[model samples]
Target: MSKALQEDSKARVKVLGSLLHTADISNPMKPWDICAYLADRCLEEFFAQGDQEKELGIPVQMLNDREKVNRCTSQVGFIEFVITPLAEQMVIIFPTLSFLTRNLSLNVELWAELWKNSFDPPTEDYEKLMARVNKVVSRCRAAGPWEEEAPMRQSSAQSLLSGSESVVTEH
Candidate 1:
């Protein structure tokens, strides 16, 4: 229902809309524990919707059906197909946004690892999964937006103080 979703929007407007949409779906780029918590909450909402659909005698959507859906598989598919592709395209528009791609790749790698071991239990113990997740979270935290602040912000500040117009781009 957003104007950005309209097919006839101007190029700049469409790009901005797409950027906003990408950010909305970029929750997986957050710290692992927080990302996992958000994902769990989303699934809970889907399950509730499924329950309502059932009560209304309507068929449940594949993702919303708690009984039939495989959480690990679904999450892996979402990250691989949805988040990764979006982040890749977004980086083209805002080159400094590669951090989004990096964080998303980390999340996808972690999710893919979990998905691969979903059936091969004993090897995928809680400790091992948590260790991998924690590592990714730490790496993501270190590579977050704050990491780029110093050079870019400092350059902009210096340029402003010198009354010079300069643009700083993260390579």
Candidate 2:
């Protein structure tokens, strides 16, 4: 049986199992515009957990309450503490999935650049970055998914910083 076989309680198998997750690794391989829209919807859902908890007089858990949470800080911490480590372990377990972590690192950079008090209004740079994310997302969604990868473009963080959707296409 495969080491990853379910319910095989060997310590080694259990250790390997712990590394697995169905996490959305920063929407890699998806159209960026669609990914961004999905990300926004996901954010709304995640933060709403806090609002619901508060109404019930329950202590909101980490990442549950948006009013009390700092999106930037929460984002970086989640990436650094949770996603990055899990992704790294999974990469070791399945090296081909290293692709999952590439754009994830870029998102960490974006969030880190946007880091500020959650209560403070967004900075010009933060707003600009978000606009760029939405613009790329909108374009991709309108165009629909691609059959082939955009071979020439670097990471979106680079494109976001440069303000160009420099995805190369064959003419």
Judging by lDDT against the true structure, name the best candidate.
Answer: 1
Estimate, for each residue in 75-111, the C-alpha lDDT of model 1 and write its tens digit: 6567655766566666665667767756564554545
Q: All candidates' TM-scores?
A: 0.61, 0.52
The TM-score of candidate 1 is: 0.61
Model 2, span 36-144: residue lDDT tens: 4454565667768878988899998876766666555455555555566565555555555554454444455455443422224568756664564544333333332
- Name model 2 segments beyond 4 Å from true: 1-20, 23-39, 116-155, 158-171
Q: List the residue pairs that clash in candidate 2.
A: 33-137, 50-64
Instruction: Looking at model 2, report the run of 10 residues with the lowest lDDT sum.
Output: 162-171
lDDT of each: 0.58, 0.50
Error (Å) of candidate 1 at residue 6 is 21
